[model samples]
Target: MAKKVKVTDACQGCTLCTMTCPSVFAMNADNLAEAIVAEIPEGEEAAVEEAAANCPAGAIEIE
Candidate 1:
């Protein structure tokens, strides 16, 4: 199973995660990266990790 991810305080409202993994991540009304679990599939773990790795602020956390 894929783990849940949280956006941390380090978030700078950067859209990198959203752009990198649109299925799991999106930009909120405030332009912050929000995880949309309904859209993310269980097998996309690598993609999610890639998005997290690409985040400049290190905001995405998997648990």
Candidate 2:
């Protein structure tokens, strides 16, 4: 199945996700990183997973 990505409340406004996957993640007005889209785009699963794994706050969620 396709992967779904989102940022949890634990986000510390870190830009790691954005830096890791600019296409799938971006910083919102609150400075927290959020998923640019609900569903991971084709071939971008690895990048999203990496972002989630690298997130220091463990805010990134991939389901």
Candidate 3:
């Protein structure tokens, strides 16, 4: 099944998520990373999980 991901308020706008998974995460107007897709595409799950795991602020969440 597809998974959901989010950048929480703890996000630091470090651009890591955007860099790791541009297809699923992006920098919004405020520069904070936001999930571009409601649910992660089947192929993008690994990238999203990597972004979440590597997040320095522990801001990215996946469920």
Candidate 4:
């Protein structure tokens, strides 16, 4: 199943998520990361998980 990914308010605008998964994540005007797509793409699951794991603020959520 496709996972649902989100960047919560806990994000610190670190840009790590965006760099880790540029295809699915982007930095908003506030510089916080946001999921460009609601559903994680087929091969992008690992990338998303990596971003979440590497997030210093632990703001990325994958469901």
lDDT of 3 by residue, 23-49 (tens): 998999998889888899988888998
Residue-pair clashes per candidate: 0, 0, 0, 0
Give per-residue CA lDDT, model 2, range 1-63, as digits (tens). Answer: 788999999999879889889999999998888898999999999999998888899988888
Q: Name the best candidate (by lDDT).
A: 4
In candidate 3, list every pair of residues with a backbone clash: none
Model 1 lDDT at residue 34: 79
Best by TM-score: 4
* Candidate number with the higher lDDT (2 or 3): 3
Evaluate residue 11 in candidate 4 and report its C-alpha lDDT on the 0 to 100 scale: 93
Off by over 4 Å in 3: none
Q: What is the Å distance of residue 34 in model 1 from its true position?
A: 0.8
What would the per-residue lDDT of candidate 1 be over residues 1-63, giving only the tens digit for each residue?
557887777889978888888888888888787788833477788889999898999998888
Candidate 1, residue 27: Cα displacement in angstroms equals 0.5
RMSD of each: 2.0, 0.8, 0.7, 0.6
Q: Encode model 4's per-residue lDDT on 1-63: one tens digit a residue.
A: 898999899999989888888999999888778999999999998999999999999999999
